[model samples]
Target: MTQKTNIQSYITIQNNEIVLNGTSVFKIEPTDFADFSKQAYRNFDVQYPKFFKMDALSKLAFLGAELLLSPITSGEQENNIALVLANKSSSLDTDVKYQESISDQENYFPSPAVFVYTLPNICLGEISIRHQLKSENSFFIFDAFNTEFMSNYSNILLNSNKADVVLCGWVEFFNDDYKAFLCTISKEESTKYTNETINTLYNQ
Candidate 1:
């Protein structure tokens, strides 16, 4: 029998609201993506000060990863879980900002910190460092939320014995719009994540 994977828990953040398993757990007052993300981090009481320095894309990815991995977070899970995140805008959100920073010929001040997050995969690195995870990590950019790809690739990592758990979902931020939906997948028996389920959750 082929090993089965299950969706342990899922978190979705968008439209100034953060929902877990279809319930609105937290929501910020109406504001732009920047301030809304900042408020979300504050509400989570994230102690990491580096969060303040992160660009909008990284901040959103970091917070979503933290929330999805909160339950079983520990030193033991290190090197066991794979991070597979996807998005439509491949860090262009920060790319534009970085471009603007250097666009000012008179006040040109390129920030290394901001420039570091220019790649969408950097968020995976950030989460890996935060949790000490030394497992397989990859980021893919598509036209939109591709549920088939998310499910297919995650299962490959698990079935291939490369990782015990997989963190799969989308973290997208462009201009004033942003949304993050992350789900943890494991071999343990729980709610199974089918392609339909993924689409439903994302569209919710």
Candidate 2:
């Protein structure tokens, strides 16, 4: 038994450009991830001050989730939204920074701020906290985006009543290269939720 679902809304953040539901909403000159994220935060008028303190990975995912979920105004919808994020790097960028901090034996000092974002799923926590989402969430490290797993897992959650909507996609950031393709899935009448569609949105 397969539960049918559709992508209610989708967002892509890449190449210093942001597109929401196939419409270009924001674009900036090429810059480092930190500066780009800060510019985007100001451009979108996001009021989250903690966003500035997040690492590159968390900033990327948080911004994507912010744009994609901005329309959900109801508390029930927020609580029922589950997160399913996958990435290839698995927080390696931050891991490298953490390693550098403690690499020097004589000056071995670990920054708790850097250490807190060592796990890839920490970005999920950032998004969850920002949106007050207490729903089920999971992060997977795949060689690439596992569309089948994303699609199936989201469908299962929806059919099982675990979530009314699922926010799932890929958010990968490492070595100054990054991309985020996030979408909301439910039984809504929009783009069909399938492997091909997922791939298309990701590549778009």
Candidate 3:
């Protein structure tokens, strides 16, 4: 039987604000990580542990997953969740900083701290760790987001029954501009995954 999948929930972050499941969760103008951290914990029930601190990418992915999972996921279903993401700038900020450190001959010491974030897939790893999800994972990049590509890829994974649930989106961070959109997909029908529904969501 071909596994079916439907849109479960979605979150979008732009203009230094977060919108979850089509509702604005928090909006911060010119806010930093600390500001977001506080708001996320307060409004979303996120408890930041003292140890195993997370970085910016991890935090963003975590929040995105949390929002998507809250309304749709149950105990066992969470374990079956998978993550697939795509972005245009694949950790370019870290790549640039790493190259800058090596540019000068005298002070050319490459920092591992900056090196680890150079890969685009680290965000997926961070999210998996946060949620303890051990399922299929993939990361891809293109010059720009192709909705057709994303929809086809996601449909293939779900239709093949490779994953019981999938978390997918486009997360692009360039310079000071950051935009993220995530949606959860499962084998159910509702108002979220239809062609017209997705188009409306993107158009909004």
1-204 per-residue lDDT for model 2 (tens digits): 656788888899998988998899999888888888999999999998999888999999999999888778454554679999999999999999999999999998889988999999999999988888899999999999998899898989988889988999999999999999998988766644444477788776
Per-residue lDDT over 110-186 for candidate 3, one digit per residue giving the tens place of the 0 to 100 score: 88877877788988987776667888998888887666777677888888877778888887776646677888877
With a 3 Å backbone cut-off (N, CA, C), the pairs that clash in candidate 2 are: none
How large is the C-alpha RMSD of every model relative to the true structure?
A: 1.9, 2.0, 2.8
TM-score of each: 0.92, 0.94, 0.84
In TM-score terms, candidate 1 sits at 0.92
Q: Which regions in candidate 2 have their CA more than 4 angstroms from the true location?
A: 75-78, 191-196
Better of 1 and 3 by TM-score: 1
User: Residue 128 error for model 1, in Å?
Assistant: 0.8
Candidate 1: tens digits of C-alpha lDDT, residues 60-146: 888888887766679764558899999999999889988988998999889998889889998998888877889999999999999
**Number of backbone collisions per candidate:** 0, 0, 0
Model 3 C-alpha RMSD to native: 2.8
Pick the winner on TM-score between candidates 2 and 3. Answer: 2
lDDT of 3: 0.73
lDDT of 3 at 27: 81
Q: How good is model 3 by TM-score?
A: 0.84
Better of 1 and 3 by lDDT: 1
